[model samples]
Target: MTDKQTSPAVSVTLESGPAGTGSIDDFELFYARRALDRFRARLGRQGLLDLLAADIEEGNAFLRECARTSDGEFNAGTTVLQARGMTSAEFLAWMDAAFAGEDERPLLAAHPEHYAMGTDHIGARVVENIGPHVCSFYMGGWGTAAMAWAEDADELLPESEYPRKMSSNLFLEDGTVVGRALIQFGDTAEGFTANLTVYFPTSCPKGVLDHHLRHYAVEFRNWIVAAAEARA
Candidate 1:
């Protein structure tokens, strides 16, 4: 994760227009480097969200919301009982689902809400940890969920199982949302690509997320390409 400047040999063929004539090899080199650089670069100190709830239920609810908004990973089975830790990407997917109101009913079923039913199926819905850091979050509840997507339609959820949120709401506060961008180069995919989609809402004006996402996108793309070549 060194920030050494890249050599001049690495460059993006910007002139190669819509008609397309840039060397794919060079593009791959550029993409990989830029991805690594942005990854190591320091994150801004604003626009972040963190939470801590005083009430256990609310705190647990908030945790649920966090899981809903986070990414998780799975073992090669369609069940949480057999699966393992969460990944950054998986946490993101879970967050999107929570935001979409996919699992509110079951998530809200914490104790006081339902006691007999609670102890019956508690061991399953849990997330080990999402990020590299350990203390970013703590567990709340447990259950098994099967993740399905239209994009990776072919690759079914690991053993058809996805981990469930363990807790609900906690105390939430402002914290920066940090992520990286990397465009992998393949023969068919020549132009730049963004893996994460910054969504916009009906209440706000259009393109707010787009502006931010694109800004990071370009920086990440260039950084990935640059960093990959430097490592070589």
Candidate 2:
């Protein structure tokens, strides 16, 4: 892995938006997006979609088995992000809009080359570039009361309800199941809290896992702020 310290920082100036003047956060996101755009250009749209489809098929089976057996070889970890002045209901509604493609700009603003296809149900695909990794996966989400993954969006609880959770099996291009992520949301006294639990194989390096924790912090913080701004 290349040392992040060795990478040159690129500064950016935003002429207009919720982010009035650019900050270090904006600069980092800008650099990451530029890198991801270069990557996408190399692969082309069709080529990337093809790879995502194959990975979905293979990764789903691997994730299902891991979930069933409580596999010991996988290490599970959680990272939580909290925001003030936003209710969980409001956040869920925003998520619904994002997943349905009704308004995905906030989501797109959260990360580099983030693409979500299909509704927030079984078989929905999400492709994201985090640092040097291009993660592709099929997603499923459910309410806390639900026992299993919903087959379609119709089976899910209304976005305004409680205990909403989304999950996916992360995969590499070759269909290797690198990890799984479960994102759960809850209402707090002041606002909302999102808990992201990830499972990675024991063989995965600590540095890699730590990097993901940092990645989640950056992207989710941006996403929450963007969503709030949109609502405002």
Candidate whose TM-score is highest: 2
- Tens-place lDDT digits, model 2, residues 76-162: 666788889998778778767777775444565566546544434334556664334445555443343331323232223334643
Model 2 CA deviation exceeding 4 Å by range:
6-72, 102-105, 113-122, 141-164, 167-178
lDDT by residue (175-217, candidate 1, tens digit) is: 2111211111111123222233222122222333344344434
Candidate 2's TM-score reads 0.59
Candidate 1 wrongly placed segments (more than 4 Å):
1-196
lDDT of candidates 1 onward, in order: 0.28, 0.61
Error of 1 at 12 (Å): 26
Measured by TM-score, how close is model 1 to the native structure? Answer: 0.23
lDDT of 2 at 204: 53
